[model samples]
Target: MASENMEISLPLELHPFVIRVLDDPDLQQRLASIVEAKAFVEESLKVAAEQEIPLNAEILASTLRPDPLGLGRFTSAPLQMDNWPPIGWLPTRTVQSQDGTPAFDWVWFGPHRHSRPFFEEDVRRAEAMPFNWLFRVRTGLQALISGYGSEPEVPLKGLIFHMSRCGSTLLSQMYASVPDSLVSSEPEPLGGVIQWIRLAKVDQESAITVMRAIVAALGRDSGTGAKYHLIKAEAWNAHSIALFRNAFPSVNWVFLYRNSIEVLVSLLRQPAIHTVENLMPREMVELNDEEPRSREEFAALVVAKIGKSIITHQHLGGGLVIAYPDIIDAATTSIP
Candidate 1:
């Protein structure tokens, strides 16, 4: 066994050929050697386990934790070739992951995890699952999907998209009441993927891959006999209707809207970040920002654009439309 602090020396002249080895045919040979090395390493681990050495406990008990402060990948020199793609859920941001990669970072949230109800408890718990501190595990996305060896959780019971201030939360709460249903309301990572896809100009195929991995990761059965999984998306996510529909075409969805006046008034009383003037893309809204409207007008205009996007999706037969007043009836009758 190698000593804990034993320093291993390497040939200084190997630097020039390092890139050649990384980018050439010998890479296959190098990969094969790594596989052999890992087998020996695993054998050592097995021996250690047989001896009851508790070798991993120190690292496991400390850094890697459930409800980690964030998730990220290792991306610096002194490259850890032995642990390529060293991604994990971490209890702190002390170690930064590769920035601008097709990856995600998560922070713990409490309110989202509320437990019981029409779907209130279920949605709250599932949405908050990302924030829960539990034993941590890390795997590359492709490896994760390959290990599953099957298609992702599909035909999710339904999706709920809304114009803010509508009864979206109430609807999700009701769904939580259903027996064995898991409701994920406004999950941030899912929302982030949409933004990343657009702002990062990520290709559609890669975006789909990332989206599938995220939903699959979060879509695990809640171990409470959950038979249905419902996702309530963020309000502005209505704009990404095409991408979302393409990803989950079979999933039934509802778009909830309310009176523009009511939405504007609600925003005025309790402002949200999105209600600020010019907060959204100018190309998307063509707003007259030079002579901005009052906060209420700006809020109303944002709501109108969201409603218009939802309506377009509905008109194209991607989802059903329900006015705020009709949500309860629609929920009781249409949703199983």
Candidate 2:
């Protein structure tokens, strides 16, 4: 295809080529079949060159990635594109705009191939892929430019929230077992967007727009032609249940609660991040302050606030209150 001696014309941006590859069923299938990381990138580059997509190493290597030392990160060149296609990419985190506005840091995720217990875990794997390491990180208003007016390919059917040590993951796993389901458990990007809204980093209009847009982008169907999408939010996120309900008025949700003693004991054995004194803010769980509270006390208060918040907002949306026992019953009950 391209050679050192050949003077090939390269495009100003790489999103169009990436979109073409991801949107084409045959091209995506062939690329997805490559098990070797290097081979995947090589093949993708080859295909781009063959299609005269103006492929070049300078642009390919410019994709963002984590540095080996974990000190900071490797950066990508600024990409110039009008509107981004939602087929293959997803927002990884939230960033600040030059004008102090909130924005998303988009990344290449290829397509949804596997459903991990947590959506962030699936995204982490995608980020590590050699194919994805070639992603372009465009600056300024990528969210607004990408899928601004589009709806999710798959329909969001349910939202699962829970108290710590509950059966939320198991519930999501069951949904994931169904072949036509797209389930994202505790996605990081959703949390990021929520944080922006909570902090008023984005105005209400833009907040709703990005929040809806990100969920739609995540709901994109993989090759399985998945029809249903569900998200199991982080346990601490129960504090923001009202915000979520307001954002997705029609989406049904369930909050899974467990015995306080059981949840306390579980957290005592192994403390979750939210259980730590300063890790999560007191305002989040409705505590007066972080001081004077032991680990056990902190866990108890957080769980209580989470439950209270959920109960308060349960009337909104099509909210359902489900206990941990009910989750167990639904999961373990065998058909006669």
Candidate 3:
């Protein structure tokens, strides 16, 4: 066991709960075990980081350490085992198995473990994929379809896209302020599935199945009889518009565009921008350059792709496209 050279603290919100749990002798023992397990996982991560492992299959397998009980119960799973791909090269999960059966279910790093078969199933489906881009598209489509057959259903509000940053979060937060509107921040898990589909050349039937699972999960959090369920996706996911259009013809689209230089600048600063490694040469060419002729030129190119997507949606007879500047202006209006 590694010596504890530093003391770790829980958040203020959990301090009281921690104290209460510690006061009980049996609970204290359990808590101690959890702490020890966590420390072991953390130390393994530290070593992995120092060694500069990519947090992919090889590193994940190497970091899998056995628990005190010698049951392979304290080790972490491969990042590929996670529902979503790792952000950059960061280790994303620390799983455990008991008697060769997975003890800890797939969980994102957080307190609230919302256990639902749909979430887990979707994660498993996504793990089969090589990447997540198409997964997101399929998930959105499935969500749209589920709402159709669901009892007391609400219409989807809109699908928003942008060319990387450019205040999409601010816009999403503003939209979330509206009553009964369920807003999901950059839902990237689906993206992983999508990427996998493209890489693995999955059949349409398999893709559809994966898509349906994700949609059902998203629908689980929606308010009963709400007017809209807004999903904001990563910027490069422009291709998903066609999938959404085919699945839900009535949904609207809000296509956001910013200066290319600004978008590139923002992407470079952030560690998680989706790359164009899987795209065609022509498509990559458009995205390859860091500079644009002008903001309007960048906006035009954005609008063109969005327009193409909109046309496809329109051909399918569904969805609306609104500009980000226009949405910002309207959001600030005083009139009801």
What's the TM-score of each model vs. the native? 0.62, 0.78, 0.46
Q: For residues 63-87, write the lDDT of model 1, one tens digit per residue.
A: 2222222333242221122111111
Candidate with the greatest lDDT versus the true structure? 2
Which lDDT values do the candidates have, in the order given? Answer: 0.51, 0.65, 0.40
Per-residue C-alpha lDDT of model 2 across residues 21-63, encoded as one tens digit per residue: 6456567556654545556657877898888886665665554
Point out where model 2 deviates above 4 Å.
1-29, 32-37, 40-45, 48-82, 96-101, 108-114, 136-142, 201-205, 288-290, 331-336
Query: How many residue pairs clash (N, CA or C atoms closer than 3 angstroms) in each of the candidate models, in the order given?
Result: 17, 0, 19
Candidate 3 residue 32 C-alpha distance from true site, Å: 18
Better of 2 and 3 by TM-score: 2
Least accurate stretch of 10 residues (summed lDDT) in model 1? Answer: 83-92
Please, what are the lDDT tens digits per residue for candidate 3 over residues 45-106? 44335545323333323333432222221332321122221111111112323322112212
